[model samples]
Target: MKPLVVLVGATASGKTGLSVELAQRLDGEVINGDSMQLYRGMDIGTAKITADETQGVPHHLFDILEVTEEASVVQYQALARQTIAAIRERGKTPILVGGSGLYLRAATDVIEFPPTDPGLRAQIEAELESEGTAVLREQLREADPESAAVIKDARRLVRALEVVRLTGRTFTSFLPQRNHLPSLEPVLQLGMKIERSLLHERIADRVHQMHSTGLLEEVRRLDAAGLRKGRTASAAIGYQQFLRVIDGVLTEEQAVEETIIATRKFARRQETWFRADARITWLDTACEQLIDQALEAVRG
Candidate 1:
């Protein structure tokens, strides 16, 4: 089987344009690895590539879910693997592209998720609601200190607790190792590297462009479609801020500023995650011959 080309980067670091060009050059089909891009009607906020921007390349896994649905990494892994196999069977290369670290890892790495019990999960969620996240955090701390130290979100806390209770094992035990999945197709991992200052500027500019392109209106449409009811969708950076604007808790200007700040922070986190993986070949985005360098790296 041909190796998979995994193009990963921070948001607004030029992954989309480069991936499209690479796909055209390599005769590859682009697969969506970004978690948010899976939802329909989230185009503007998620910075989804336009049909024209796809440049005649076939893309998979974009806009596959409704706003009300929650996305699971387990489900995504299955779907992405299936897509990759089909693409390769057709004799086309599969280019996996996105900024979503866990999603990308799930699609390419050897990882197994623990089983979920709805009853146990519901019980844990009730405890979270009644006693609050602090209680759950303390519980996780006692049970799985590693997960406790890093997981701050209520949902994740609940999940860690649930796993610990169900399997009597640490949540971290299920984490993907720094190696590829057995029997899976090999992958050439590429990362985009940019100067911090320039990346921040690019993030701010992208946020501004998202606003000008009617991100608020897109949020409004999704909100009307029950976005707030969706745990994952409502918590997205731009959508969360704009939802506040819709509720009159924040001005449009304030929402844009918040989105910019949030995006910069998210980009930083993305950099931290991707940089830790030494297997990835980091290409400076400033290089004019970036695509050539990437092709060379792959060929070599």
Candidate 2:
């Protein structure tokens, strides 16, 4: 079986187009590693590739969730591994592409994720809402000092609390996810790098294009589909802003500008996250022979 080839990059860095091109060249199947693209109705905001754009390359793990459903990284890891195996079974290489750093890492790394309990998760989420993340961070500091120090955000903090509460074990005890670890399988990880000014321009242009291309309409449709009920989907950059457009809060113009700013910051965070992993072979997206370079990286 062909070993996996994974692509990492920030939003609007040309990963989608390049993924399709590579799949065409390498006899590979494409898998969606982006967290937002998993939703069926999130196309315009997510820049989901169209069927026409695919040019007949098979894709997986996309459009598999309702807008109301939440996405789980642990579930994605299992499903992605199963998908990679299935693709290999049919004698094809698997090319995973996205800007989601954790999702990509989770899919490739040998992470023994802590167990989950939905009821406990709900209670913890309510505590987060009531007590705020700062207070929860204090509790986590007492419960698991190492994780409390390393884990940065509320989402991971919530999960860490869940693990500590559920099994009476520290989150750090379950897996070595804090650092770049070996993959369970042989794989090549490729990262896309772009000049910062050019990347900002790309993000601004993409968000403007999304605005002109009926992003609000798509969000309206998703709002009707209970997008706000899904914690992850609701907090997604554009959707959250446009759902406000539906609520008469942010005007379309304001939402577009906010989305652009938010996306640029998101791109920076993606850069920071992926840069920590020394395993990835970085590629300049502007290189004339990028596909060739990518192929060489895969083979080398």
Provide the TM-score for each candidate, comma-separated.
0.97, 0.93
Error of 2 at 148 (Å): 3.9
How far residue 48's Cα lies from its native spot in candidate 1, in Å, is 0.3
Q: Write the per-residue lDDT of candidate 2 for residues 1-300, one digit (tens) a residue.
A: 477999998899989888988898889999999999999989999999999999999999999899889898888998999999999999899999998877887888877777889999999999999989999999999999999999998898999999999999998898655455778778888999999999999999999999999999999898888898998999999999999989999999999999999999999999998888778899999999999999899888
Clashing pairs in 2: none
- Expressed as tens digits, the lDDT of each residue in 110-221 for candidate 1 is 7889889999999999998899888789989999999899997888888999999999999999877664455366889999999999999998888899999999999999
Per-candidate total of colliding backbone pairs: 0, 0
Residue 41 Cα positional deviation in candidate 2, in Å, after optimal superposition: 0.9
Looking at candidate 2, the ten consecutive residues that score lowest on lDDT are: 175-184
| Lowest lDDT block of 10, candidate 1 | 176-185
Candidate 2 ranges beyond 4 A from true positions: 125-135, 149-156, 172-180
